[model samples]
Target chain A: MAATYVSYFGFVIKSVRGMFTGGPRYYAWLSFLVLLMAAGAAAYYRQAVLGLGVTGMTDQVSWGLYIANFTFLVGVAAAAVMMVIPGYLYHDKAVKGGVLLGEMVAIGAILMCLLFVMADLGRPDRMWHMIPPFGKFNFPVSMLAWDVLVLNGYLLLNLHVPGYLLYKRYRGEEPAKWLYLPFVYISIVWAISIHTVTAFLYTGLAGRPFWNAAILAPRFIASAFCAGPAFIVLVLEIVRGWTRFPMGDRLITFLRQVVLIAGLINIFLLISEIFTEFYAASAHVASARYLFFGLHGHDALVPWIWTSISLNVLALLALVSRRFEQRGLVVRNLPLAMLIVAIWIEKGMGLVFPGFIPTPLGEIVEYLPSANEVVVSAGIWGLGLFVMTVLIKHAVDIETGAVAKNN
Target chain B: MSGGSRIRPGDVKRRGFLKLLTALTAGAVTAPADAEAFDLDAFLQKHFHQMSDDEKRRTLQRLEQDYNDKYERDDFTVVADGPTPGVKFAYALNLSKCIGCRRCVHACVQENNQHRGREERGDQVEYIRVLEMEKGSLDLEKAVHDYDHEVPAEDKYYMPVQCHHCNAAPCVKACPVEATWQEPDGIVVVDYNWCIGCRYCAAACPYWARKFNWIEPRLPADEINPDTHYLGNRPRYKGVMEKCTFCINRVRKGLNPACHDICPTGSRKFGNLLDKDSVIRRIIDHKRIYILKEEVGTDPSFYYFFD
Candidate 1:
């Protein structure tokens, strides 16, 4: 028993070390990511010494790029379910192989989500306030507390299941049924919960009229279903081009179909939201108006919203059409790529910013994130990319049998 | 700026953190308030409710000493007090007499020891947001909160909004740590020492009544409101949320809030709501009063009426 445990422990240590020391390309990319993260850490240090006041947020526009990114990344993290539901629950052969990739993506996205939240916090040091038994956690009421629970929970599930599955695969053993399959099933439901709770975070706010709507949860879920799997497909296609990761075209195409249906539904929900706002013709629609058009001659977001709509339509058309796929690899992938960008824009500026446009007291204070805020945001994004790169490297190494001696 | 060498306990959260969490089992996350002139007692003080009376006294004494040393002063005292029994506070603003001079706004700033967003950086954080409304109607969409126009313009009426101290205070519920809560006297108070400064309460507040301290609250030592309450008008650190406490320091002591006392037009009237003889009770019984966004059902103590 002791000898078996020792061998397994030695293997894990060796694999982790091997993950760090790879080819020059791996080292160079990691170095680039580390440098970006360091720059971000330095910027965060300044922000920590100062306050969130250093950012462009004010009493009028309380949340900015950091929050916007957080909201978007939550959807991205939740998107892991698009694959998990089909793979684990439905037991579809086309998608089961790629479930680990979806989880790795979620792990990265959720990490970014947490980092953005810390960046936006005024006193991140006081973060322990959310944990129970020490600080009073306003749970079951505060949507944000719900968010804290689900985000971390989802991350843990992803981390555990992937690590366990990877270790089993490394040792050429099937995972125990009681151990990981139950979590995969739980994750399927938890993915929807994570995004739904995130939507509640905004909609629950009676103050922000822009976010206070019943359609918000469905809207968020639809967009997330589209954005998350679509991102996975984009990553898979790109990764396949460079290495032998063993993902099938059938799975990639199946994911595109999921993105297509969800994308169209997301568009329909948006149209319904826009119609409700413009048709009602009430003061409550002021935020929607500010988001779609300009409010009080402050139309900073006009182009951004239009660009999002344009990309959504274009990407939808490209996805539904088979002509692009018939042409070549680049042509076949264009729609999927466009759809990913479309969702990023829609979720980032299109969704989060407009809520604060016509401040609750009816003040029009235009908010554009300052340079420091931008640098801080980019730094977080770069950190997210770095996490993805390293995790994916490990995943590819395990799958391709480069790290496992027997395979 | 509040008088200081600006020498901060920048690493205050890190120092003596293990000691503070001696009561807590897990110590991964913590909120720290560090000062350059470290007093071990103040830095490691327990939560407000958890503190013993002796601890509270020591905390206040240490706070006073810390502020005096950090801000370079000798006369500073941080009082830890609470609401008077049998008193429920209420506010009534006479819209008919309001001229939109923004006096209450500036008055609250000076009285509350708020961060002076005085410079052109547009960082000034204030509790009161005076809305300029059309003379004949209240259209929030058209009302401007940042108008710099002269007071009492020919075609407009002014409405200054601040914390309503609602009976069903959403901000209190929205607080994850109960940092902000409704006291027995009906004023919503924030325990500055305990707040994590998440600002969720700010978003939950319908009136934008809550304000976040984006930077360390600075008041020129001379301008510091030395006559302060722990939950009201106390000098605050950067990164916490504060709001109109109805000046608990003064009102609990039989004195008027600074904004109420400074109003030139007598537009702002505040008194105990439960008192049958109080002016606010008379206004509610006899005057046609309106609560802002009453559809949301916050049941605020503050009422706007035209007398």
Candidate 2:
């Protein structure tokens, strides 16, 4: 038993070393990522020195880019379950290979989600205030606390299951089904939970009439289901480009269907929400009005939201049409990429920022991310991509390189 | 190699040494002043309900001392005083009496030690927002928060809004760390030191009563209110959430908040809700008063009434 623990410890170190020892192209990519991270860190340091005042956030718009990114990443993190459910629960073979990669994407995305949260804090040093045994967390009451718990819990489950599977494969041992299968099922439910809790973080707020809707969680799920799988498809295409791994065309085909169905549902949900907003023309319609057309001569968001919807509709068409995919990878990937970007903007600023427009008392204050905020956001994305690169490299190594590992 | 035990001291020591290095480096950045300033006891202070009277007093004293040292002010004290027995605090505002002079806004800032230099920075922070609304139209969506040309304009009515100190405060319920909560006397106060500054409270407030310190709040040394309440206004750091505590410092001493006292027309009335004889009590008993968004079931103690 002691030997087993020692062997496991050794295996983890070896896996890390193996990950670092890659081709020159791999090292160059890492260096580029490191450079971006350094730039972001510098920008964040300035923000820390000057205070959050450096960001475009006023008391009028208390949350900005950091939270927008955090919200999107939570959905991205939750999107892993789209593959985990069909691959494990229903025992689908076509998606089985993609599930590990999906989980890997989740692992990277959740870490980014957490980093974005830390970047958003005014007193990052006081983060210990949320930890147990001291900080009196208002659980079951404060949706923020629920968010903190579920995000961390979801990250843990993803990390554990992926780490367990990879380590077992590396050691040339068949992973015991009992040891990790229960956890895989747990991850499926937990993935839904993390995004739901994130949605609740917005919906439960009584102040923001824009997010105070019953459809928010459903909207979050539908968008996430589409956005998450869309993101994975993009990653899979990139990975297949870089390696000779036997990725079937059927996998991409399967995922585009998921994206099409989910994306249409998302658009449908959005239209329903818009109808409710404009139908009665209640006081709450103030935010929706600001987002869609213009409100009170302050229509800065008008062009951006319409442009977002157009891209979404365009991508939905391209995703569903066989003629579009027949245009080839570069051509097809454009719409897929647009679908991802469309969802990113829609789920992000389009959702979070409008809630503050024509402030609760009816004053119109606009928000745009300051240069420092942009730099910091870029830094977090660079870090997530860097992590994704390493995780994908390791998985590909297991599939195509020295390890003759199998499930 | 060791045949019996794989565990090794040198490996453990190397790991320990690296961890120590990281801690020292992190400590240097986070705690630049005396290690004593980041009081472990204060940093790890337990929940208010879990603390004894002595513990509470100690915590307050440590904070008072920390502030005094940081600000170079020797005569600053933070009181931990609670409400008078059986006292339930409430407020009433007479719309007919308010003149829209904005003296109450400035007075509240002075009393509460809100960001004094915000105006100089092309910014402003105030607990009380006075709105100029067009007469006979209650569409809050069209009200203007910043109306410069007004001694209560001919066609306009003024309604100054602040924390209602509701029985069920959304801000209090929104704090993930429980850093903000309602006191027994119906005052919602923030433990600024413990707030993680997520601004969840600010978002949760329907009235937009809470304010975030975008910059480290500037209360000039000369302008600093020596008499401070721990929950009301001590100097705040950048990022923590703060709101009107109904001028809790003065109210605890049977005094009116600065805003109440400064109102020239005597529009604001505040006192114990349980006291049948208090002015606020009489206003509530006889006047046709309305609280904002009562359908939300927040049950605010503050009331607005017309003549």
Candidate 3:
């Protein structure tokens, strides 16, 4: 067992060196990526030094693109559970090694979600008030408190469950097979709960009529399943092209099916939302009107929402078509890329913009992303992606028994 | 004879005094073993059927006193036989006989102990949202109030909106926290401390009767209302919401809100909607009185009838 661990670790070290010197000039490319990250860091500093006033957010549109990204990323994190639970708990051999990557991605996405919330809060210093005893933490009553708890819990689960399995495997020690089954079941329920609660956080608000709907929780889940699987597929393609990652075709086929099912549900939910809004045409429907059809002088959100709907339909079609799903790498990437973007738009803008469309005065106002807002949002994305890249690299190494020999 | 002599009046009297002292001390320390006991769980468990006659009498007396303390006032007690089944309130608005001076706004700020803005910023904290509506557009929809422009721009009518003390308030129902509630005589009040700052009440209110303090409220000591109600304009804590309470302190004290007393245009009106002979009732019956967002079905006590 010790010899196996040592040999695996040695292989990882050689692989890292080979990529830089012996293999295709990947080291040079990595250096360029580092430079890009440095640029993102500079932008992040500007945000920290200046107050939230520097952001594109105004009193009229208190939350803007950053929150949209945060919302979208949360859905992505929830999507990882789709892979983890089915693969481990259900004993799916095709999805075994693949599930760890999803969990790693979740860890990255959750960290970004937390960071986005910190950036959103004007007084980030007072976040400690969320702690107990000294702080006034209202349990079960404040949804914000619940969000903090669940997001953190989900992230820890992703880290520990996968991390433990990978650790045991690297040691060439037989990991207890039944150990993860219970966790996998918990992850399945927890995964659905995370996204559902996030939806409830918004829809539960009786004040924001735009968000107050019974369909929202299910809509969020549908979006998560659609977007989450789509993202994983895209990442798999990228990994396959770049490195000698052992990704199975069976796993890809399985994910594509899940994406198609989720996509149909997402589209259905969108239609139902429109029906409820147009049919009722009540005072509560004003915000939805502003989002879809321009409210009194507030036509800004109409184009964005329409584009989102279009993208969603297009993505759904791509997934439903078996020809497109099982196409050549380049051809398949197109639909997968489109699906990811479509979900991002649907989750980010479609989810948040409608809530603010018709102002309390029944006036429609537009939210334009200021440069600062874009940069800050970009920085957060870069950070999450960067973290994801490192974590996935470590995971991939661990999985193929390459990182064992180095330690 | 010796035993009788030993049991003297002095010893007997001393024993009686000690007994009386012990009884008085116990009574003072524990209060009465009635409904007002420290053990609320025990008191709650004791069913009405189980309650002693003395307990029932004490409870009734306490309830009666609480009722008197909450509602009854010497100046404005409810008169069941009157035109309205409550105190008669009269509102006199003479828009034709006035100018758009914002003295009323200032009066409201000072009288209500509003948070003072920074000296450098010259901030305005007026709850009364004044709308300078254009003429010939009788519809409130075309009402364009350029707040950035000076007050009373040429050819504009000033309209102010506050908590309408609505008879059927939508805000009261929308409040998940039960922070804002309707008073017995039809006044809407917000308990600032009790509010969770979720802003649901603000969204539900047709008249926009609520305001959320996004940041901590800053007011000088002198600016604070010493006689502040927990529900009304007390110095609000951060993260809680607040709003106009119809000057609840003065309203309960048989006085009008400062804004009403200081309005130059007499455009602002107030009164008991129930009173038949009252000016508010007269305006509602005789003239076209409009409530903001009437489609929302929030029956506002604050009515606007063009002169």
Candidate 4:
């Protein structure tokens, strides 16, 4: 089945590459690159000239889309570690083919994380202060400093481990089998740590009662696994469509099982959050009320949250159903798309906005990212995809040994 | 405008040089002797003792040079010198008489060097919130101060809340940067330069006394007060946090708070807690007074006394 899958995909790729011959696809890729660079230049110019005010953020909502995207991307990045560790360290042959692809996802996700952090900083120039002594970042005390250290460490790990393996393979030297094993274990634990720490950034705030739950970090991990695996599944389908890679339906079924478990955990964690908030009858319950219904007179966030909840339920049902998971194309694709959108809305506005409602001053200030913010975000995403495209192209070339065959 | 040798000492005529020197000599010789003999160190020492004699002299010289270059007046400096030995500062408010006239608010802005911004768009000057209250209810739960309607409304009594200068301030405790600290006199002061703008202190303050400058504060140069304290408002940079210092710069200098002094009804009272005869003490003894969020055990130095 695997050999047949590879040969059939190879035939399609050869035909397409022969017809294109570095023409239309190349131009299309170039156009995307131009669009990305233009958007980045515009955003950079605006930020340099007008300061953070160009981002549509105010004192009331000091954070905007930058932070929400940061949170979401960190979760996605952490999920890559799970795939790498299980496949390589534990010798899970079923998942081994995904190990390289998982690292590639981390490379793109971490870049997004860094960009988001840069966008949110009031003095992006002062980011160098995170370096050491002169800047006095106040380690251990500030969760931000910890996030900076861990994220960079993870990026370094991904870069060196994968680059070394690829280099050895290119030289026709057999790579050390055990070289990636230890890193894989570390990566697994590190993956869970990244999302936990990201969640810690919000939950550690004692003042923001909405985020002060002990279950918050666990919930973050569960949701990250659910959305991250689902995204990987979608990427697998795209890879299958575009290239000669032999991805098996059985592997897709396994990924669905992972998603189903993650979804169940995510739903359970959210239920626990609701239970605690409603049961406690504390002032903190005010935040929950604002999120689910409305507080005082504000209702902007209610509809978006309900939609996330419904989509999550629907995705969970589809993913757990064996027939639905195995179904070709449409049925399998719908659940993955639904999970991604559900987590996006949930982690983006649903998670952040409620944490600020009934604000410290008892004001309900609604937040909406401006047009510039949205455009800049889109540009960042395009840049990530551009990087991903180059990476996948390189990986496929190495794996196939014939650039033309892969193309 | 030249390639090196165009302008030289020979470019100026000898006659012009001599005339210029003569004018300088005349100006120097005939200048006010008192101005030349100014003993600012001696005078300033009499007022501000915090500085050592050498420090005083250097400060005096720096001040003269600064003034000579640009004597842009309206350089208001609120004094922040420590009080006379046995004095312990305290404040009390007569909530019953506060008419919500905002006279105290205006006075605070001026005295504390708060930059004025647009009424609708800019940040508030001081850290005081004048919450309107109900006649029969002291219960904050029943308080109708958070009305969506515009303010200066009829049938409401105002209760102004500043940094209670809490004895157990959450803001002081939560400052990871140590930018904010409680002074011996029970006032919480922020080192504006040291603050990282993390907003942790702002979040911890239950009274919401702190305000973050999300944008650089813009004050027209003419309006910039020349007299500045480094820790108080000289001119804060963008992103740092600031709050009311209870007119620390003034009250520590043995002057009443600008807000108390300017109150039309004398609703705000400030005095030394150690002095039994202080008017603030008399108000505390004679009237019904309350500190906000008292149940939280912050032990605030500020109080609201019923007239």
What is the per-residue lDDT of model 1 for residues B133-238, given as tens digits with 9 covering 90 to 100?
9988787778866566667888889999899999998888777777888999998998887787777787788887888877666667787777777878888877
i-RMS values of the candidates, in order?
A: 9.7, 16.5, 27.5, 20.0
* Prediction 4 global C-alpha lDDT: 0.66
- Give the alpha carbon lDDT tens digit for every residue of A1-407 in model 1: 99889868866775777578667887898888887776677556657765775576777677788888888888888888888887888888778888888888999999999999888888676676666676677787677878888989999999999998888888878889799989888888898899999898878877677888999999989988887888888788767876678877788888888889999999999999999999988779988888888887888888988888898899888878766755676778777777777777777678777787777777777776755577678789889988887788788888888777474
TM-score of each: 0.92, 0.93, 0.67, 0.76
lDDT of 3 by residue, A39-80 (tens): 445544544433343454433344667778878888999998
Which of candidates 1 and 3 is the stronger one according to lDDT?
1
Question: What is the lDDT, from 0 to 100, of the residue A324 in candidate 1?
Answer: 72
Q: Which stretches of candidate 4 lie over 4 Å from their true place?
A: A1-30, A177-180, A279-281, A328-331, A402-407, B1-99, B112-115, B120-126, B134-157, B162-205, B251-307
Residue A368 C-alpha lDDT in model 4: 67
Q: Give the winner by DockQ: 1 or 3.
A: 1
At residue B103, give the lDDT of candidate 3: 70
Cα distance off (Å), candidate 4, residue A125:
2.0
**What value does DockQ give for candidate 2?**
0.32
Clashing residue pairs found in predicted model 2: none
Q: Pick the candidate with the highest lDDT.
A: 2
